[model samples]
Target: MKAAKPLPPYLVRRYQGWKATTYSENSTWYKHLANEGQHPRAMVISCCDSRVHVTSIFGADTGEFFIHRNIANLVPGYEPDGAQHGTSAAVEYAVTALKVAHLIVLGHSSCGGVAGCMAMCSGHAPELLEKSSFVGRWMDILKPGYEKVKDEPDPETRQRMLEKEAVLTSLNNLMDFPFVREAVEAQSLSLHGLWTEIGAGALEYYDPAKGGFYPV
Candidate 1:
């Protein structure tokens, strides 16, 4: 096996900068977190898109949130066949072990995962349809969401609708977990859906009453 390489000079410099500034300023808080444990108030499941900064959006500090990120920010329906499920495991740990009060599914505009799902479902992305494409299989979780906006005339609008649909779909699928359902039913946990626009830095939240997303 090849020996591991050291971090690049630029990344090392960035880390040193952060350690000198953010870490130095909050060393006590960091020490406290190390001594005590993380007791985050919420769990935010967001897309892996680099533009979507979950903590920055909420002004959250370290140890304040239990965050899980994945492609399309999806949560698949409960499947107990013993296959490895990273997202499901994170949700289980957050709900049962962390006992977070709020569980949020955060989707975003201009999501490549959503676009790939659209392309695959529309027969436009042959590569993604291949069995070897992990992204394609991962995005299969959003197929139900794609059906909601497949026929929309405007491509841009359809993408936006599908983005929100991803959030809604995840919120629905999250209930499939027995632990999540029990917590929600007993009023110990609440579920939320959010969509954000990367360019405008605008945010919209799903309102179950109106069955649509509204600016926040």
Candidate 2:
């Protein structure tokens, strides 16, 4: 393997600054965490979008939340084919090993992955239809979401709805894992779905009783 390129100078400077100030202030806490290992109570599966700041939104400190970011914040149905499954592996470790009490799927507005799924489903993105296209294949997780909102007359509303659907789809798929289902049934673990409005900084949470999302 070839040697990897060094980090950008700006990032190195920012890291140095954090190490000098933030790390200095919390040196004891960081040392404790490193010694004890993490025991986060919740696992947050959020989007890869840079705008979706999980820690900032929840006001979480280091070692508080076990976070996994992926395209559209999706959780694929359990498929133990012995293939390389990063998201599933993360979920397995968080649940079976870490014993996290809650797992939250966090989606957001204006998601490019959701838009790509919509485009692919609506036949607008032929390139994404190819089997080898990684983005297209990953976006396939949102196909069910597209089907749910494909009939809407307004395009903008449909797109927004699909974004929310991504959260719902992941929540549903999380249950498909046998361990997750057992844990939920045993009342040992809980699953949650959340959607965020990037520009408004508003959040909506899924209500199982209402079968929809409500402002939080």
Candidate 3:
């Protein structure tokens, strides 16, 4: 086993403060929540990157949003199985258990996973090709988006385009869930796609009018 790295002093101090504040101020609510159950109004599917916190980004408090984090925030079409699924399980709990009113597929710029997918496209990481089917599978989801901006003159531009395309594709995939589809058709639920840029701290809102993402 690898040795654990020591926590930075600042982070340790911050955790102490956060713990103190949370226990003192929110203990009653949390205790009730632990006993009764969670009641959230929305479900946010976001990347596993440390920088993109769905609750903090949206200023949501506990019990307001059910969150699921994954490599690229990809939403696969729903499948019923006895198998354990990280993303699908969260979706099932949110839709069936919590009955969230909205589901948001949140994507971000400078995503390492999307970058990995882009690298896979260039025939690099051949070891990844044979052993790791994940990147290939994810890139396959973005195939339509890849085709959309494949002709872009700059390679960097193409990757950025692909990144946005992956977001759109994931949003589309979210709707493929039967519960989500039913809720949406019944007008009880809504779906949204959000694109956030880490470097610029700029959020791009997906616009149906422009048929592309735009700065918010």
Error of 3 at 22 (Å): 2.9
lDDT of 2 by residue, 88-118 (tens): 9999999999999999999999999998998
lDDT against the true structure, per candidate, is 0.94, 0.94, 0.79
Residue 146 lDDT in candidate 3: 60
Q: Please estimate how well model 1 matches the true structure, expressed as its whole-model Cα lDDT.
A: 0.94
lDDT of prediction 2: 0.94
Q: What order do candidates take by lDDT, descending? A: 1, 2, 3
Q: Candidate 1 — which residues are off by over 4 angstroms?
A: 1-3
Cα-based TM-score, every candidate: 0.98, 0.98, 0.85
Model 2 RMSD, rounded to 1 decimal: 0.9
- lDDT for model 3: 0.79
lDDT, residue 104, model 1: 96
Q: Against the correct fold, how does model 2 do in TM-score?
A: 0.98
Q: With candidate 3 superimposed using the best TM-score fit, by how many Å does residue 129's alpha carbon deviate from the native?
A: 1.2
